[model samples]
Target: MEVILARPRGFCAGVNRAINVVNKALEVYQPPVYVLHEIVHNTHVIRELEEKGAVFVEQLEDIPKGSIAIFSAHGVSQAVKERANELGLRTINATCPLVSKVHRRVSLLNKINYDVVVIGHKGHPEVEGTCGHASGSVHVVSSPDEVQCLQVNTPSRVGYVTQTTLSIDDTAEMLKALRRRFPEISAPSRTDICFATSNRQTAVRELSKAVDLILVVGSKNSSNSNRLREVAQKNNIPAHLIDHAGEIERGWLDKARRIGITAGASAPEHLVTELVAWLRENYKVRTVREMDGVDETICFQLPPI
Candidate 1:
């Protein structure tokens, strides 16, 4: 058996910055630093931060007044920011710059009287946050089919923004449908999907061709991680998404000559190493290598103290 790893697989710039924000807060401020949500979607990362005194909360009311609070990398809606101010919390904006860009774009579109449309899954924290940025008529659609059912106030003048974690091919298809339905609909100068998400998916697409089964290491709730698994499966390669090495099933290895491993943007590299170690111990793994792919150099600056 051979194991092939995907390049540019884990810890995007935004996730790195968000994790650092919590670490710095722990060092600079007192204990019980409040984080609005999971700093990133990985359970291991959250557990590690929790061990270091980070308190993760879903609502602002749960946090004590005047305490230090950091927003998640997923970003927050305008309402969340205002509520934080109303509660006298010392807030740090740890929203990923790319996600922040989408928020700003949607807000600008709403201000100019253009009916806004956000392409993302319903109830996702990022989707909710992006939608909260819009003040006027806004709609959220996850599929091209949903685009046809939209009842916009001004169909002729609509603008759209997308979640940063979505599959590029899926978003492109939805965008095409939106344009077909609303001839005057406008979109951002570039797609809203983050560079890290694109790079990871590209790497997976390349790796899928050389391996028999693909194992994606990430939490189930991770959107970008799910997309990576789907990208491989869409190419007719068998794939599985697991949180860690423990979730790996012996059945997945049956008849598989080569296994490919990839991690999501929020996943830690240590988990990948553990998976490889497990493979080496259980199977007669002859060769383990990383496939040639993009070397991501992008890094986001930490939030101001």
Candidate 2:
């Protein structure tokens, strides 16, 4: 089997900064640094950090008073921040700058009297947080069907935003449905979906051309990772989204002479390395090369010292 690696895979700038902030906070401050959510959604990354005394909490009240608290890369609503402040928590927000842009857009829309329609999975932490900002101004729509059946208090004044880690095709379809229903609805001039999500999907489309099977390394709950797998399958490539090497059955890949490997932005590089080593030892893996694509250099700065 030959392996084709996808460029711009694993640990996007946002995830890097969030994880680093937690570790660095642990190093700089006292033990048991608290995080609002999974720093990035990878179980391995979270477990490793948890071992270092980073506490993950869903509620601000759960965190000890006066503790050092860091928000996840997925970003949080102003309500959470305000509550944290009320509790005297030292805030170290590691929200990805791209996501921060979405929050600002929602904030601006609310001020302008535009009701926001967020296209994302319900109960997703990112969706929940973004919704918090536009509590009275926002409504959630998941699938294109939801858009068709969706009710709006003011369709003309409707604006749409999305979770950064959504399937491009699926979201486009949802947007089309929205536009059909609300002809006057406005969309973001700049995409809130972030560059990394687009680049990874583009790379996977390329991978599907030469490879018969594609492997996406990411957690089950990871939206972006799931989108990568879906994008490959949509292109008629047999694909599987596995969390690690243990999930690789080898049976599914037996017929594949060329296999493509890509990880979600929140996934780690080491997981890819571990899978490659396993393939090299067991399968007759002979060739390996990275499929070229867009160059990514986006970075989010650490919170003020």
Candidate 3:
């Protein structure tokens, strides 16, 4: 058996910055420092931080008044920030820069009297946060079918922004639907999908061609990670999104000679290391290799805690 790793897998610049902010808060603040949501989407990362005294909460009201609170990398609605202030919590914004850009774009659209359409899965923390930025009419649409059924107050005065972690191809199709319906709809100057997401999807597409089965190392709730699995499947290749090596069933490997491994932005590299080790010990895998792909050099600086 052989294992081929995807290049540019695992932690990206934004995830790195978000994780560091949590760690830095732990060092700088009192114990039980609160975080709004999973700092990233990986369970391992969240567990590690929880061990170090980070408290993850879904609602700001759960946090004690005047305590230190941190927002997740997915960003938060303006109302969330206001509520945090009402609670007298000293909050740190750990929102990824890319996500923050989307929020800003949405706010700008709302200011210009354009009804905003957020192209992402509904109920996602990022989507909720982005929607909060728009005090006016804002709608969430995930597919072309939703786009067909969408209704905006002013058809001519409409603008759109996407989740930073969406699939490039999927977003393109959604854009086509929006353009056909609202010919004068406005768009952001640059694409909202983050660079790390685009690179990982591109790498997985290339990796799928060389392997019999593909394993995406990421949590099930991770949007970008799920996209990776879909991208491989779109190529007629079997793909599984596993949180870690233990999730890999022995039977799933029985029919495959070549396996491809890739991790999501939030997943830790140690999980990937352990996964490869598991394959070697349990499956007697040999000839481990990493495919050539993008070398991500971009890094976001940690915000002052």
Separately for all candidates shown, the number of backbone clashes (residues 3 or more apart, or on different chains) is 0, 0, 0
Question: In candidate 1, what are the lDDT values of residues 87-118, reduced to their tens digit?
Answer: 99999989999999999999899899999999
The collision pairs in model 1 are none
Instruction: Please say which candidate is ahead in lDDT: 1 or 2.
Output: 1
What shift in Å separates residue 287 of candidate 2 from its native position after superposition?
A: 1.0
Q: List per-prediction Cα lDDT, in the order shown.
A: 0.94, 0.88, 0.93
User: Tens-digit lDDT track for model 2 on 38-152?
Assistant: 9898988999999999999988899989889899888888888898999999999888888888888788888888889999999998888788877457888998787887776
RMSD of each: 0.8, 1.3, 0.9
TM-score of each: 0.99, 0.96, 0.98
Q: Tell me the lDDT of model 2 at 136.
A: 59
Point to the candidate with the largest lDDT: 1
90, model 1: CA deviation in Å? 0.7
Candidate 2's C-alpha lDDT?
Answer: 0.88
